[model samples]
Target chain A: MRRIVVKVWEFPVRLVHWTNFLAILVLCATGAYIHWPFLSTPTTAFPYVMGWMRLAHFVAGWALLAGLLVRLYWGLVGNRYARIGTFFPYLTRQGRKSFLGVLRYYALLSPRLPPHLGHNALALTVYSGIFAVMAFQVVSGFALLGQADPSGTTYLLTGWIFSFVSNGWVRFAHYAATFVMGAFLIAHVYAMWVSDLAERDGTSGSLFSGYKYGELEEFEDFGPRPR
Target chain B: MAHDPHNPRETALEQYLESRGVDRRSFLKFCTAVTATLALPASFARKVAAAVAADDRPSVIWLHLQECTGDTESFLRASRPTAAEVILDYLSVDYHETIMAAAGHQVEEVRRHTMEQYKGKYIAVVEGGIPTKDGGVYGCIGGHSMVDVVTEVCGNAAATICVGTCSAYGGIQAAAPNPTGAVGVGELLPSIPLVNLPGCPLNAPNLTATIVHFLTFGTLPRTDSLKRPLFAYGKRIHDNCERRAHFDAGQFVERWGDPGHRQGWCLYKMGCKGPATSHNCPQVRWNDGLGWPVGQGHGCVGCSEPGFWDTMGPLYERLPNVPGFGVETTATKVGLGIMAATAAGVAVHGVAKSIQLRAVEKKEGN
Candidate 1:
């Protein structure tokens, strides 16, 4: 058969995705070190290992926040596939039907893979949940970081968090979120690889090249008849 | 017992302090210390002095219920210009259940008389949690339930002060499987203007300074959402810790009796709750600036925080278990366990999928 190359992921979305991925990687490392500093420097004087770790964590956190904000903004103005509405797979009847179909495919009850331009319904739901977790981390991260300098503007903004729960519980939530994101990362990558191998539709390369190979009929969802 | 408000010379505090040989200069110095302790500037010392020397000293009624008397003991042990002497000389402590000379019917009579005499003018200092289960039968004083007594006493009180962790946030008595259903004073009397000076054994200076703040300004000191004075509970213990430099340097004492512990390194890894706990144990230093829990090489138990016994426990562990699991499990353990299980499940699923794929390919070949 014939295959149609379609633009799925926009440049901005891909850029934010890559940047967020890097930020989360650094954040996990630095956050763990700060919580439990496994490494001990011979001299307590010169390097300030924990200080650098915390600084890196905070900088990466802010960077992630900036990328998230930009991506959310782009979700408003980008192509149909990049729209925020696509993330909520249960919002439409077609999307819901596709979700069930994808679920059956994962359960090994169905051998056929559903055709789609961007993310499948199941992937959309999972990514949406991951975004929610990321948002929680950003909020709680700032709350924990602001505590270091209580007199600063950040503290003023987030200090009320303590009134609701103690700092210990807040730190616990942040740590728990890391593990959640970690688990998501593992499952997400594995699923992506499996999908790329099984479908052979340039799924993995689409993230880098911003295009996916699909059946001609699938292109009809983009609106208007293709010449 | 009403005294002239116009004449400072007629005040009982001046006469009492003067009789104890506490000079005017020494009294002023005490006021200055109190002012500083309250996080007030140097100029507020004069206002404090004048307030203390005023003709009307506020009467105080101290109630002890369901407690170990540790708060009273700590109050007596307060040094650094000696809070016991200053507090005794300053306030008209008419009804203290522990220290009062009068006892039995006479003491009860005096308590009644004093409560009536100084109604809406005295400070009610509650020192322990009040049991509410079974009509508060778990705790009582002089044939009155703790709940009834607190409600009655605090009803007419100008303000109420919860002087220890028990009275502040139910402390250990309200820990898991709280059979007695003990609760903090705030929970009992939510409408009362209450101040919590929470600690395992209440910090004496906080009580003294709070009283002085009232004596000076005729109002309670500014408090946090927990009803704790901001000057004492304004910052986390970790922020002002002596070994904070070691914390920032990524140096930690991994275990007790380790080289790091010997060298006085950070105790964060040893489950020091200092980072989460807010108190002035580092700056105020228990026993007249001599030492504190961290200074003496032990982690802070976070006794001042609400539900600490229930929430901040496994004392030496980094994190407490998530509640309502019917089993004790730390957040890290649960989180990492789930992640491991997911990874294992993913691998199993992947293997199964590859087997199914090979079977499909074989079927196609046939």
Candidate 2:
């Protein structure tokens, strides 16, 4: 029954979030098929199955890469709350305290929750780490794909990574990383669902409609506002 | 077979082979092949020749335990010029079971006679695994258990060579529950030096090269962990496969008569265990260097490896349940294992999430 006059994650951030979610889902589905092709299907459709899997994997990778680039640009040019400082939690002691404070709250040891006008320092740290890991996956996946095309530039640059990791180890890491990603997905969905349930009015709308209704201090403002 | 310090110029190997009437050219060719197989320096060939010419021919006792005699048959079938015959004779076959004209009591007497005569000077070539289960009842020769015979013979020999998968790694007989409790010579007797030449019916060239190395060096050649000579079993078949180019290009034979199949693409999809198996079959081939399985349009069955008949089976079919996305999709073992784990994890996570939600609602109601 309260209206929040705060901004949390502007248009670009919301757009990146939804697009990346869908892309990652498609990528993981196709990647699993590529990694271990199920033989239960009786059709002689080997070619068709592999082609779509590869196409979807590459397309999703490129989209995620693009989204990352846009986010990087926003990190420098966006508002105080939308800048790299918001994502980088260890910049100041207050940021560190809030980060550790929220972790304790999640652990149920803290009676008081942390406050901020952007991603809680804990959220910022995790999101940044995930981005770094995704970047690694992209590099590794392209290196493997590039082996087929002799003249591919990505192959030339990253083929050494492929050789370095070894085909068996590379494939292992790719598969293992998916479970980590999937775990993050489950936790992420649960958190979103729980947050919506707790706040009720317009809280979940920010991802789809880019706005929400809540108390002034109920949420962190994550972007610029016209004076 | 000691190196003669007395006459340097008249090296021992040259004199010995000359006595056997092998010309200089033939000796040199054999020397070169040895160098190539052992991956020795080119200059080592002359030394090898000198070594062979100088050293007194080391005696060999080729024994037949429980086997189909397929390995000896393979060697005997060696074509014109009969390299197998030449190599066997050249090495001085002090004793053999199938090839020697003497049989029955004379055959048994000759083996015992040679074992006593040569004693620590002869190499014991074992052609099959020793069956120990049921008092080693599965196979016996001359009313003696194979395990007892191998222990008695190999006990005083200079070195032992297991010449087939049956001898080296207990081939088909050792598969699964291993009813016979068959074990290779090395496992049966650990004190003696051992070399394994593992193949379904072992490669004759590999056997010849090992003998040549022993004759040439007056010592056993360097071998890998499996007691396989490094020169022959060092590289995986996949690494040297002629069809490897197709694998790298992602072209695989999905069906018996598909376009990829007709084009002679990689047979990885057809249960070819070449990636895991190691041998020189892809290079040297078989039947006196004529053709191997892949050449006949059938995928490699990985016959050279230990327990291949059991682990690398379902022979003609590709890997079970590999998820293919395109024209030539072949799923590897790691791929299938990972996906199965992922699916299981997701299912558990979903159930946990539902349980947590209900707990949360109960707490709120309370």
Candidate 3:
């Protein structure tokens, strides 16, 4: 089978990913404070903590928006595999099968894994789901942030939602969603660690190196499919 | 007890008092107290005196149905004239089941006789809910359904005063499934002018006020659709709560018996339903104006409100959770980022694997 592989993501994309990861961790810790404020540290003692947390959240939000824009542009202008369609596998029947093929391979249900030169169908599906959730978080977070800034667009849209849902219920939903995200992060890390340990095919390193092994003959004989 | 021989029209009150043995000064004092309770000026006190001094003290039929006698307790402790004779002297309480010495047929006969003689002119003060379940079998007095008796008398009476939550809004007994199908007086007869005093054992002044308003104005005062006097049940307890300053400051009592609890902080976190419940109890108070629930280190459970038993209970708990935007929490956003990164990671790995396969394929081709 022929294999085709090419460089797609630039250094900016990788830097944004790692930076976002650290930002998320810091945000979660500070966010727990904002929600329950477990610290016996009086508001006077660390008056700046809540303020800093808010500042950090705003900065991170802007960074995330920037990252999303850059990623979208790259999807259009970058290599064949870097195209937006590659990240969305359920759009096509062949793409959907390849997505399932990746699941089967990971589950050890198949002896011969589907050879791919880009994101596997399962990975594509996950990316799509992530995109959807991030969009939702952005909307919800902005709405919350708007509470303090009545003049802000986020506040305007979300303020209406708050009134409709009531303030207490809105606050509770924000809390529950936070816990859900926390659980997802734990599971995600565990899965990554397991995959890296078992496969060891530069699973994590490929993020930095931005290139991977591909068969030239396979590229000629068979079209590129998700790994 | 002797009639003032000057006003010959005062003979009925005089004869009734002579038989019951209520003194004259105490009767005038009770009229003055009722006038004051009605929030009427001292000038109106003379009107009350004139009414009492007249021959006809309006006949009253006090009925108790499915209730805990809370209204009776409130009226007994009415704190105005400071003498039991005061209340007994003003009104010719012709029939009252709980306080009247007459038994079974005798009380029933008195009720019937009063209804027949005074009928459209008498005041019907109902102190409990009327259960209509299974043809009103849940409650009865003298083998007659209280519902039947209430309908018969209330339909013909000049005015009706529902004295407590049970009679006013069906109270605790009408909660949830409402097995007894209990209902208030206004619900049973839409045409009659019924004033509701909807406390768990309503404020005595409200009852007294309605009576005085009727006696003075010849009609009940304008009331809300719930039949509650707007003067008493208009504002929420939260608006007048003593710890309202703490609530405005966002200070809350996190749990029962906490330091904040001892300090008498806001009980919003402990499920004080005062913010949503309207009543004058916080201002008027209970036990002759000594204290109320909030004053006695307990949250206001909103007992005076409709469906309070279900809506405001597990009384010492926090309000239900509400969803808000995360200023601090962004697990969903972060998770999405992580998943995206992971996807990119998978893509990189796939490309690397492809490169390796390409090199192997070129060697085989060569």
Candidate 4:
């Protein structure tokens, strides 16, 4: 079978993905340090460790938010694969079938891989959920930060979150979201590797190179299927 | 200083203070203390002094329900001008249920008289949660339910002051499974301008500063969304903790009586809610700046915050569980458990996939 190289991800999508990846990494590490402060300095004068960690967390948080905004913008105007409509697998009969096929493959009840140039239905659904979690992290992060200086700009932006939930619960949700992101990171990497291995396609590499090997027919109807 | 006996405004507060043996200098110092406590500039001290020394002393009606009388006890222990001066001279406390010399029907009569005479002029100070379940039978005063009493008293007051965690945010009585359906004074009387001095036992200086602010400005000081005075309850305890350096340095007290604990390291690990609790306990201290809970080698229970009794617990744990979970479980526990399960699932799936691949390879070779 002749493999066709498909432009699955655009330049903007790849850039945002890598930036978000790095930002999430930094945020998780710094956030954990802020929560538990596992490391201790030799002297009492080293007060800036936690301070620096908090600063890094804030910077990375803003970076992630920027990355999300750019990605969301691209999702509206970018190529077929990058569009937000591609993420909702439940919207089409073919997509629903492919979702079940992918589930069957994961359950070891099927041997054949689901045919897709970009993400399979199950992968798209998981990515959609991950994005939702990321959005929550951003909101909760700002809410928690706003409490630090209630009169500042951050508070003005995020003080309304306190009206719905207490700061402690917000902190809890933030922590829970971090764990979700962490678990998603692990599963996402493993699934990407597995997909690449089983399908003999550039599934993992497509994230970096924006290209994937697939059948030529898969490129047709690239946008979301008409409901 | 000699006062003109003829002028009513000239001699009212000053004369009263002098009669209590508090001279002009002492009274001015008390005013300065109140100004400082309210986080006002040094210039505001004279304004506070003038306000307190004014002839028309504002009337205050203090009511107690479903509380331990701790707020009044803390007030009595205030160092500046003393609690007696605060009640008698500072604001002419017309009827404090705890300290008033009147008994039974006489006290009720006095309260009614003051409320009628000074309608929409006196301050209504509430010191406990108002039970609302079953017509608020859980808490009552002189056969009057707390809900009815609060509604009635606050209806004809200039402003209401919730003087403790109980009245401010329902305190411990309003904790989990709130049998009486107790709620804070703000919940009971949302329309009235209110100030919440939300401590386990309300902070004395906070109450005094709030009263002085009302007397000085003819209105309550600016409050947070929780109706707490911004000046006193603005900053988090963690922000101004004496052991904050230790927290920043990552030196936490792991256990009570440990070397780190004895050496006064951060209590972050020992379930200190200081990081989340917003109060000026560190700055103001308790019992006239003597010491606070964290200062005395104990973590803050976050008694000053709303819903603290329910949400800010497992007092010895770092974080409380997410609200909906049946059993108490920390975020770390739940997060780590889910992550561990995912890791295990991924490992098993990988092994299964590898085995299936090997079997297929063997079958193809055959």
Candidate 5:
């Protein structure tokens, strides 16, 4: 088997990935605390428990939004593997076949799998869904934030949401999306690990190093499958 | 009484006050209090007094639609109606269905005559919701549907002041499964300008202060998009809550009659809607400024907001349920349950995948 190493994930893409991961982690943790104050600090001694949690949640929310914006922009002008089309791989005939193949592989119905150096079709499509969910979280989070001060300029921008849904629902959706994102996180990690183990080619390490080792024959990508 | 055109009680407010033995100093003090309520500079007290004392006073017609008369009760039974209520006489209220002695056809004539005389220039204070279903047969006064009354009276008035949550956002009548198909005055008169002072029973001072601002400034005070006067509803109740220190301190009442409850800790955990509800209840308060809901150790029901019934409830719970679905299912419960299911599913998937991988490796070895 001839093995070759190729750079796949660009540095900006890697940065976005990690940034979103950290932001989501901080957001969920602090968001849960803000949603329900679990810790009871003494009033006089420690007056800013929820305050600090709120600040952290706000900061992480902004970070997530920033990372999402960067990723969205990069999708427009990045490498083939990093472009927006990669997120909707199912649009291509080969991508659809690979998607089914990936599903079959996960279902343990298939042994041999179509080789892709980057994300498999299923992973990419799910990532797109995760992105959409995160975008909704940001929008709903802003609407809730604006509820804090209804007369301010922030309210003026985001208050239009109240025209559609009330403050409680905005809050509920934002909170619920956390778990949806959490579910995605677990599934994503498991899928990546399975892919790395099957390929034995640093597929998981590629997240950090941006390089994947594969067979020269496997480099066919979605070109024509095997003749 | 009735509007006797031949023997008009056309006394100016200052003359009426003098006749009633109200001293100028106290009246000025009242004006200053009104100025403060309007959030205007104290120096504007004289300007406000002059505007209020003007010979040409605005005729105010208070309408009662599909409501509990709670707003009217609050307006009449204010804690200290002495100084504050002089402002009411200044408004020269032409017609109030509840308070006016004239009833039946005579009062109807009074309302019609007032609306016609002050065509395009009378303040219509609406106190309840208007029934829209079945041609507004749900609520009527003198054989006239509330829809027609509001459309006709408020249609030609200077502005309509929706005095309660019922008249502003349809109150309890507009809650889920709204049988009467009740709607607020603004919904019926969307073309006209409106001042919506929504509350289960709004603080009477806000109503009086809004009228004073209208009379003094020759235009309504600046209002939010909901048409609520910013002076009253510019800040959230939580922002000015006296127990805010407790909230920031992480001290909250875990349950009713607990140590935190006795200690007067924050009621946030008690489903207080102060964080989301915007009103000056914490500032103006109720019952003569003696105390408010939070002050009396009760959580705010968020009565002043647009749809407190549907949006701000279940009143005693911190967070609301799934909106529009009408269930007690909380977001946290549903969220945690899904996460746990995912975790379990992932665990099962992990074990199965690992076992399958071992089996595949054994097959390869064979």
Candidate 6:
């Protein structure tokens, strides 16, 4: 066996990855403030703290949505490892078995684990769920934003959401999605750290550098990935 | 019921008001206010005055179904100033079930006569929800279900006006797990043109202005998707809220009777749905220009929105009760719990991974 580096995440994927990370961070901070403002001033005074917090939240929300759109586009036309198919690991019987193996390993039932050059079966599946939630957040966020000005173009596009779900629940769900994402992020980072430590591989560093190190064959191969 | 459009004997509203005691000046002032509320230009006040004083007024048939008659009580029992008097007189309400001197079957007969006489001409003002479940068995009058009654009444009318939240969007009766399956007039009469004035009991002036707009424009005012007139429901209460300065400053009344409450801080923390609700309550108050709920230091209950009773609940709290978490748990509590659990899971996973790493490294060394 020999060690060689394989480019896994493309440049656009990495760009969107960090962009969404920063966007989500800013969004959570500013969203929490807008949800329940922590800052205080005299009632007689108009410091516009809530106003600024709302502006920041809307800006960050837009950034996250933009990053998501870019990622979705890349998923359609990116590498084999970066394709949208990678996000659905349980669609096939082989994929389901691979998913079970990853799930069992994470449960600590077995010391052995399945390894992939890109995302493993479970990681991609979880990423898909998070992406769905993120999409819902964008829709619900825009729906609420459109409410501030009912006659505006934004309302023309998003006001139909109120016809399905009640207006208040949309707001509650958007706030809850942040925490759901937060919990997923905690597990995601921890899982990556453990995998990097256990495999002695560049799983954690793969996000930033778009490359992963592994030993594949008698000949050193740096191609797409090992099937 | 001797109403004729071009009757030479018909008393014009202006002549009638002048014959009683109301002067021209007070009546025009009322017109100005109505036009302003309708978001019309200052010049349109004259048009409103002309419409109000023009020959015979539109006959209104006020129907009462599953309601408390709070709307009628509020509208009739108020201060009855000259402005309100002009509105009351201009309405020409033909058959109000609660206030009409004629008894039950006689009024029903009168209603039948009016419907026949002014078929596709009279304005039907429905005041409450109509029960539709179990063949609309919950509420009935003269052995007829309210659904059928409203269908028959509003069916032949030119246009219908839903006067309260009950009639607009199935108010308190349509709250969660609705027993009777009560629904609004809009839902009952889909084909009929409607203007919804939804408040707990809607501001009488809003209903008055809606009538004035109909009389003036010869068409219903432009409405939002919910059928509420845009002039009233177009802007959110938050944008026009007097407490907006406090909201911008982040000074919320954290709890009831707190220092913030005493000092008249923003009621957002008290679950004021004003931010989400659309109404001119802060401008056109309840009970004849007296203090409104917020003016009296109570948070808005969002009475105007469709199905507000269900959508804007845990009414005393800042959020709608999160679904599936029971009634007590809020998103903040649930979110904090999820975060704490995630933190704990991460810590345990970290410890487990370190132990596994040590075991593997020791085995490799051997």
RMSD of 2: 10.4
* Per-residue C-alpha lDDT of model 5 across residues A129-169, encoded as one tens digit per residue: 88899988888888778776776677787778877876666
| lDDT per residue as tens, model 2, A1-227 | 34555555688888888888888998889877655454323234343555566688999988988888888898888766668767788888878888888777455454334645455677678888888878778777776566444245876776677435443345546666676677667656655554455344444676676565555544533333422
What is the iRMS for every candidate structure? 1.9, 8.2, 9.0, 2.0, 1.8, 1.8
TM-score of chain B of each: 0.89, 0.82, 0.75, 0.91, 0.91, 0.92
Cα-based lDDT for every prediction: 0.83, 0.70, 0.66, 0.83, 0.82, 0.84
* lDDT per residue as tens, model 3, B1-366: 456657656656555554555566666666776665555687887787665456545788888989999878876764444323344435636888767777889878988998999879999989888898899999998898978989988887888988887887787888878999998887878788788888886776566667667766788877754677766775667777888766544456777888878878777767676754667777667766687888787887777766566555556543342225333434345545665675676556555545554565577683
Q: Count the backbone clashes (under 3 Å) in each candidate.
A: 0, 21, 36, 0, 2, 0
If candidate 1 were superposed on the true structure by all CA atoms, what would the RMSD be?
3.6
Task: Please give the distance, in angstroms, between residue A51's alpha carbon in candidate 2 and its true position after superposition.
Answer: 16
Candidate 5: stretches off by over 4 Å: A222-227, B1-11, B19-22, B41-43, B90-92, B322-328
- Model 3's A-chain: what TM-score? 0.79
**Model 6: how far residue B231 lies from native, Å:** 1.9
Instruction: Give each prediction's DockQ, rounded to 2 decimals.
Output: 0.60, 0.06, 0.06, 0.55, 0.60, 0.59
TM-scores, all candidates, are: 0.92, 0.62, 0.53, 0.93, 0.93, 0.92
For model 6, residues B1-366, the per-residue Cα lDDT tens digits are 323456664457766666656677878888999999999999999889888877656688889998899888767767655665556645655788776778878778888899999999999999999989999999988778899889988999888999899999888999879899989999887879889999988888888888889889888999988999999999888888888888877888888999989988899878899877889899988777787888889999898988887788878876776668797989999998998899898899788867877787898893
Model 4 ranges off by over 4 Å: A44-47, A220-227, B1-10, B79-90, B322-328, B357-366
Query: Where in model 6 is the C-alpha error above 4 Å?
Result: A43-46, A218-227, B1-11, B133-138, B142-144
**True lDDT of residue A110, candidate 5:** 70
DockQ class, candidate 5:
medium
- Residue B64, candidate 5: how far off, in angstroms? 1.0
Model 4: pairs clashing at backbone N, Cα or C within 3 Å: none
Error in Å for residue B285 of model 1: 2.1
- Candidate 5, B156-214: lDDT as tens digits: 88988999899998989898899999889877778797889988889888988888888
List the candidate 1 regions with Cα displacement exceeding 4 Å: A44-47, A148-166, A221-227, B1-12, B79-84, B322-329, B351-366
True lDDT of residue B268, candidate 5: 91
**Candidate number that wins on TM-score, 3 or 4:** 4
In CAPRI terms, model 4 is classed as medium
